[model samples]
Target: MTEPAPELVRGELTRELARAAVAARTGVLRVTGEPGGDLHVVHGLVVTVDSPGAPGVRALLARPGRTSTGVADLRVVAMMAAVDGCFAMASGWIGGCHWQDAPEAAGRPEEAMPPVPGVEPGWLLLETERRLGALAHGRVSPHRNHLLLTERGRAMLSGPGSGSRREILLWANGRRSCRDISMLLCRSLYAVTVEVVRMLDDDLLAIAPVTPDPPIPEPVRGIGRSLLPRRRRGASGINDTLPPRPPQPARGQRTLTPRRTERTT
Candidate 1:
């Protein structure tokens, strides 16, 4: 019989475990997820983040010669790598993976790993969130799902803009969506979309719909009003404001005629 599938771990729950490990100041935390990589944290500091898809800590941080190799340097690099890994994990670059708190899972590699300074687990989580936000603010758009450049958007590219603004303006052509622009320009869709939206807000791009307004509804007619039931007012379920009247006689029937008043002598 096939063994049961490993429980897929969510990024949020894994972060929580990291927080706990940081608080305890003793446990090791392992987080495995897609795009496909693993992160090992010991005593609230990250040791290694191995993901082939993304640049490792060494690539992110400039390496100094043998003279500069110190405990502080190692720790800083390790911490940076951890942050990078966290971003990747949170972004779901890696496929769904599992996590465990066992000592074996947290074991340091046989090779000398970069030394990481003691950092708070909560702090790391907070930093990751902040970076994610910054990443979003630069590329992602909250209001727009699609990107379509206007005539003005095209003109701005050759006009007076500088740097990234010029690049985005040049790339926008009313046909590509934000994701398309992202891939074309080697930038994040979130970042590209934000700029596009800014341009749109500035009237530099136009994407409003051109359909005509809906027709006004006709007024309610007497027939519509007649369908409603008439309401009576009173605690006893009858209109009480008007005085009660004697019941009318049935059709073709007459009520007892009042006796002829006897002439009172």
Candidate 2:
């Protein structure tokens, strides 16, 4: 008889990743959930993380009118992408995950970028947890909440600006979320989220209320009319329907008469 394949214990994502790292596993852990992504593990170390919720190395390097082809630049961008992607995956809901053996390829083919140094799972988890705690304390969500610039934000833009703050201020028009701005600017999601939260604290930004989707109308029952039964004739040739009558006050209740309206016509 053939033996069953060893099943990976299902539990928290952090625990599973730690287990894989300890075992020195070389494979891809495909996590499934909202904004899910894959973690490329090499000899128990996480080299890269790919998630739709955050921009990747290529996107980070593909800034408008700017190009970087140096190996050093690539490594820096890859490191940022890995950390940001891990945060993106952990911040949201994770349904489940499964590991797949990939002995041949080091990373995804579509990446087309050279591999950088591998990051330890413990360090990655620690960094991600730190970021998560900071974001939670700031009451900001990179994926869900939309932001808008306040009067102070516009004023701040008029002064000498540095980093991505000016660009973020311009983009927060009560329509785009932090994730949207991150993709548009090709910046790290964690960085963008942190900046947005800071701006919010400085009274430079405000959270925009998300417009709820319109409720779906329920399907009408039956074909034409309602499915309710119609009035029927009684055995005495009278309709079963009762005649409309004015409401009467209950016993011991004061019955106040309604005021009559005077017609001018």
Candidate 3:
């Protein structure tokens, strides 16, 4: 059977993944962009997704107290990671993609946890689109905008809330964005973004004003190397060789008296 070309357009990445899934192709689809990543497909399902923009299942499971060893738990975590990874890519700039065929064994050892059931690319794309809609509704950019806690939020944190909310509040110091908080807490970027939006609606969080970068200092010119014209150096220069004028007589004397010279016979 003829295979589709490996190269993919930026916005068509998700659709191509869906096509690959429907075709039951097995391989790695490497996406390229600002924060691109790999989508490992087994048969037609996406086994796993790896993107720098979002934390992976390994990091999520590796948290201090997340010690679930059941097959069900692993599957849930893997699926969450996969969905979050897709969302991360879709939210950013996707330049293009390339696919390469490989045996399933090639990706096995790289798994942070045991194998879990794969997710359908079509469903994954839909879910990612839904997330994008939610972000749009909230008027928030998870990757671009920084967040900070309001006065009320600070007080609420002192009272009671979910641990996740508290961690987010603690990290929201007018510097970190939703993505930043997500990576720091090993939580899903979508989740963090939604939570941040809710907090904003509740007046508990505010978008931090982006501080403009400091202006670059102009280069300093050396003393004698100024751009203005240099003074002329040699003879024939009008001012260069002029003799000093004699001091004028005191205010009352208008003219100098001539000195009498005695002629010798």
TM-scores for every candidate against the unseen true structure: 0.39, 0.71, 0.72
Best prediction by TM-score: 3
Cα error of candidate 3 at position 8, Å: 11
Stretches of candidate 1 off by over 4 Å are 1-16, 19-37, 47-97, 100-111, 115-119, 130-148, 168-265
Q: How many backbone clashes does candidate 1 have?
A: 14
Q: State the lDDT of candidate 3 residue by residue for 1-265, as single tens digits.
A: 0111222222477677777877888788988875788998887889899999899998888866778978899899999999999888777767888897754454556663328889988788778876776666676777777898899999978886756678888899898888888999988888888888888998888998888999999986674657767766654576557875788888888895899999999
Q: What is the C-alpha lDDT of each candidate?
A: 0.53, 0.79, 0.79
Candidate 2 lDDT over 1-265, as tens digits, reads: 0111112112466777888888888788898976889999877888889999999988988978767879888887888888899888777767788898864646776453236878888788778777776776677777778898788888887788745688898888888888899999988898888888888989999998879999999997666556666766565554347674677889999988799999998
Please provide, for model 1 over 1-265, each residue's C-alpha lDDT reduced to its tens digit, 9 standing for 90 to 100. 0111112233554555566575654344444544456555555455566553344655545432323457676666667666655554554433444555535434656433334554555566666566555544333332233455567666666677566777666655555555455445544333555576677767666554435689999987777757887765565645556778879999999779878877877
What count of clashes does model 2 give? 0
RMSD of 2: 15.4
Single out the weakest 10-residue window by summed lDDT for candidate 1. 1-10
Sequence-dependent TM-score of model 2: 0.71
Cα lDDT, model 3, residue 92 = 71
What 10-residue stretch in candidate 3 is worst by lDDT?
1-10
